[model samples]
Target: MQKSRLLMKFQSSGHTTAVLRAMSYASPSSKLKDMTSGIEFYDKITYIEEHFEEEKDVLVQKL
Candidate 1:
């Protein structure tokens, strides 16, 4: 159960990172409109990646 939970969290974090990466390349007007929210999402991804490094590292290795 704990392993499944960790995997779920790691997958969600990866999705969050993908969204932020997309936002990082958005058009200037869209970026300006959403920059603050995008930053928050990015920060959340960083926090999760830092706190759950083991799970994240496994995912990275698999990919």
Candidate 2:
């Protein structure tokens, strides 16, 4: 069964929330062991946002 259909069958909000939390715990993105890596990712995106006007939507390249 598709996840969306499974989610929709829940008539109770509490059950839905519990299932969603369980699914979140099981997801791959929840496995980041290094907190600093998340902070670095945030810093990178903010740096790009601050410089977006200068880049003018140009493809960012790594040197």
Query: Tens digit of lDDT per residue, candidate 1, span 1-63?
Result: 433554465476877745655666766654653344445444545565667756777667766
Worst 10 residues of 2 by lDDT: 31-40
- Judged by lDDT, which candidate is best? 1
Model 2 per-residue lDDT tens digits across residues 1-63: 333333344334556445544554566553242112233334455566678787654645542
Off by over 4 Å in 2: 1-37, 56-63
Q: What TM-score do all the candidates reach, one by one? A: 0.26, 0.31
Report how far off residue 33 is in candidate 2 (Å). Answer: 6.9
The lDDT for every candidate, in the order shown, is: 0.56, 0.45
Worst 10 residues of 1 by lDDT: 33-42
